[model samples]
Target: MDLAQFKEDVIQYSKQIGIDKIGFASPDVFTEMKERLRTQQELGYQSGFEKGSIEERTEPKLHVPESKSIISIALAYPSKLKDAPRSTREERRGLFCRASWGEDYHDVLNERLYRLASYLKERYPDLQFRSMVDTGELPDRAVAERAGIGFTGKNTNLITSEFGSYVYLGEMITNIPFAPDEPVEDSCGDCNICVDACPTGALIQGGQLNAQKCIAFLTQTKDFLPDEYRGVIGNRLYGCDTCQTVCPKNKKKDFHNHPEMEPDPEKVKPKLKPLLSISNREFKETYGKMSGSWRGKKPIQRNAILALAHFKDVTAVDELVRLMKEDPRPVIRGTAAWALGKIGDWQGKEAIESAQMKETDEQVLDEMRKGLEFFTENV
Candidate 1:
């Protein structure tokens, strides 16, 4: 079997299976990424959600013994929502970022990789490969960059010439040695847009991100969001897209290639009030398929309360009061109280004062006080 011909066939097959981009790369250690990871760790820049130690993450060979090459894949998602639902003053909405706009990307990419693996296995029964999506120990961006899928942008996103950075990346480490493609050689140059535009200044520098300060990471956290970033996240429910939206490279880069990648505008941009009271089953049925739901509804609900506060939606005051008084989770109760304060509704102020009398949790009581203080500060 001609290896070159086989590689060509694989590329064609990937396109047929709706893979937007595909490339091959050597399984050598990612030296530059290793140093960057080390630096990020030392600076306390890590997200804490990272899957593995620095060594395991940068070395592709650790996950796949006898790995000869890696196959990187990218699937472009819709950058703009079609017929998006409007967040009216009477009924405001919270947004999940474009990355979570459609069905869970991990499942979509895993299916693509599985199909590719099945095809390869049929032709070469001894094909040894380990597939990985975003959760894998192997760094997807490093592999994508090495495979010539795209260049790493200043925001630390993989920027493809065709799809920009609105793409989902996944990879497979295989024993078959495939010739690598040339890397894209474009730079952000003098553009400090994304770095400067970060809501929490999480970009620190160009490519270095302090995830702790990142609104995207903060939205996924189950605990109470820090006070400073409460207003920074704005209406975002899960994930932050400020950096991606500000990128010049991503201008007019919307791709609706796969039907599954298309977002239901109402679902992705659901009304904030509804989310506050969505039962477990309703939340599952409504958003279970989206990637943003992975952290479950706690964080999303907390963010929803914050979103209501962001809008100063007096319309949601009753719902926020209910959550503040009756929610089972302390984080939910406390965050709702804080949001009630931020919203500055007279009714919310009264609700917080009333709840404060019966609230036993110190944190929730503190939040109630903060909420009440908002009125005093204005007065």
Candidate 2:
């Protein structure tokens, strides 16, 4: 088999099938990444969402026996929303990070990988390949870095020359040995904008992230948000983009190439008040298609309550009062109580006082007490 010719053919076909960037890499052990992962684990900097053991994550051959090469692919997503809705005083809005703005990239990238695999299978009838998107055991960023898709930025995202750091990455491990591509040179020299701009200071010195302190990770948690991060999370409902948005490398990099990747501004940046009471079915029907909804409506609703507090949206006080008085979920009810206190309205205080008598949950009662204390302190 002329492996070089096959590699060329695969690259050409990849472009034809809408893959923005493609690169090949040997399936060698990712020693550096393994060490980094170990360090992150030791420091408790990892988000609990990581899927695999360190060995499985760093070694591609374990995932696919006889894996000789990895093919990394990237699809650029839009950074700027074309027609974003305004967040008025009466109608405050919350934001889903850029990665979750459009259709779930997991599905989109997986479809592209399936097509590429089919094309390769036609020529090599005995080919064995394992493809993975974001959730796969193999680290997509490490694979893409080795494959020359992009250099890893200080913000820990793959920064492609053509698409900046806004690209979604996925990879395929195959038995075929394809010549590897040269990695792009690291280019974040003397730039600390992302670290400096992080609201919670999650980005530690030397480009490392403390995921526990990251607003992106914090917003996804189902539990009550810590007091320190509540104000920092701001209007974010799902994920945080402070690091990416502040990167100089991503300057003016917005791609609307794929129709499926274009964001519906209203959906991604919905009014906060409506989100407080959105039914599960309606939440699913509206945001289920986006990557942000994967954690379900609870987190989003919780964040929406926090967002209303961030904006001090007095108009949302009635809805918040209703949530505190009647919501089934303790987390939602407690968060609403906290938000109402933050909003500091007379009705909110009155509702909290009323609910305090009826609230049985210890946490909810504590939140109600905290809510009333806001007015007490002010007085």
Candidate 3:
């Protein structure tokens, strides 16, 4: 099969299969990025997730073995509607990010990529290929950047001049070799909109993100959240998009109006109270199909309680008191106690007094004392 014609067919098939952007790249485009991933991993900037698999992520050949070319595909999931009303307390419960409010993209993108891969197989019966969304050991964004689909932006998201960073990336690693395109020139010139908008200082430098400080990753991790990040968590129950929201490149693009990617009207910006009361069974049923549920109900529930604490809702004090005593997760119990204290209600004082006496971990006990102090100072 002719390489040029094969490349064109791949692009056409991706479009027919419903991908919005398609491009190609050589494995070598990863030279600098491989080093960066390694350095980031060593410094613990990868949040312990990259897991010494840096070599595989940097070398496509290690993944595909005979991979001579990579065809990168992008699918857009833009927010078409203006954010719904979240001004009232009741409306803020169970809120999910726009990308997660619908069916999971892993299912959607995999179904499309499999079809495209099958087409490639039928066309060139001897070709070997593998397709993946974000699940594989491959460095997806690096491959996408090399393919000229986009450039890595200061926010650490790949932003295309056309689709911005709102697009989801998937790729096909193949034995067939096509001439690769040069990487696109970055257009984020002197702009720090994403940097300035970050509430957690996750954007440390241009094109660099410390995932440890990233609210997005923090919300996704199943482990206990570090103490310093609690106050800045605010009302976000899942991922943080403040950087993307403020980018000029993202602002000018047409609203992402895909029906399948629409944010649930009930979830866009959640109220804190009802969210706190959701049962584990309810959490599984509501968020099981969504990507934000990767960390499960505990993190989202914890985030809600912390957001309530941040808001200092005196009305939530009784609920916090109950959670402080009843929740099994020490972190959750500690946060509930902290919120109750921040609210400084008479109920909070009782809850803090009870938790301080019963709590075993030094951290939880310390939080209990802090809650007691918050109430004592305010009382």
Candidate 4:
């Protein structure tokens, strides 16, 4: 097929197969992105990211050594819900992002990309191709922007005209040359609403993000919650969506009506009480296919405790006290102690006194004492 005819056919077919938007980018876009990765690594913005993301982001060529043209595709995820839950209150009814509300997108989108690659391969027997969703070394957003898919927003998410920023990106790197698309102009135009709306200062300045400061990173992390980020965490049990919710571009999309992306009824806003009771087996079974499940239940449970503490719910004080004294995880105990103090009731005080008397871990004891002082002295 001729180059122009091939481009038009492939682009049309991509839309028919459920991809919302498609763009063709040249390999040269990687040059500036390479420098940005190196700078971020040097400044320690990536200290906690998996070691592989650092290596891969720095080297896109690793995915397709001789890649000449890249096709970027976007799939819309959901954002609406029947109800929104408070930070600590887990309810049967709640709102969940559209992206995570359905069957795993990796399996769905990768299968689509593979089919596209296979079709092209059959036509050109000697064609070379490499495809990836969110899992690989290539900067998917950058490729998308360069290919005229959309502009990159200040929140570091890719935004398209049709899907807004509520889309997931995937790429197909190929040897056969296709005409590259034009890079879309930035549409943010002095709108700092997203940056100002961030509960955490993750959107450090404009399009830059300090991943360490991002609530999304904090909720998903397996390590101890950083003391500095606790208050800013608010009720976000997983990733924070405040900035995205405030974006004007996102406001134009009809998330509830998008059938491809639907929220899981169980996860919309899980109650803290039930979350505390979740067994490892139940957690795995319920969340096994979720994007939030990557870190296991420990982080979710810890975040639940933190959220309860943030709400300062007195009814949860008793449970927090029990968890402080008996919970197996040190992180959970520390957060429980903090929550008890936040409650500041007679039961909360008594729980703190009992925990402080028996707690052996210096860190736990210290947090317990602080929890006690926060209630008594602050009261």
RMSD of each: 1.0, 0.9, 2.1, 2.5
Q: lDDT of candidate 1 vs native?
A: 0.91
**TM-scores, all models, native as reference:** 0.98, 0.98, 0.93, 0.91
Tens digits of per-residue lDDT for model 3, 1-379: 5879878877877787688888888865367877898778777788665533767777777767888888888888865546565444433343455557666888878888888878888887877888877877676788898999999899888898877888888888888787898889898999988898898898888888889999888877655567788778777788887888788888766545446666665655656777778887877786677777777788888888877777777778777888888877788888787778777778778868876777787777777887888866875
Error of 1 at 157 (Å): 0.6
Best-first order by lDDT: 2, 1, 3, 4
Model 4 residue 362 CA deviation (Å) reads: 2.3
lDDT per residue, candidate 4, 1-379, as tens digits? Answer: 5988988888888877777788898766466776777777787787364436644664546667777788888888777655555543433222223456665677777988988887778777778888888766677788788889999999888988887888888988888789899998999999999899987777888888888888877888876687788877766677878888899998857554345456566575677777777898998787777676777888888888877777766667667777888998888898888777766777877877877777788878878877888876875
Candidate 3: give the clashing pairs.
78-256, 92-270, 92-271, 93-271, 154-207
Candidate 3 displacement at residue 329 in angstroms:
1.4
Worst 10 residues of 2 by lDDT: 200-209
Off by over 4 Å in 4: 50-59, 83-99, 256-260
lDDT of 2: 0.92
Q: Rate the local accuracy (lDDT) of all candidates.
A: 0.91, 0.92, 0.77, 0.76
Which regions of candidate 2 are displaced past 4 Å?
Answer: none
For model 2, residues 254-365, the per-residue Cα lDDT tens digits are 9988999999999999988888888989999999999999999999999999999989889889899999989999999999999999999898998898888899999888
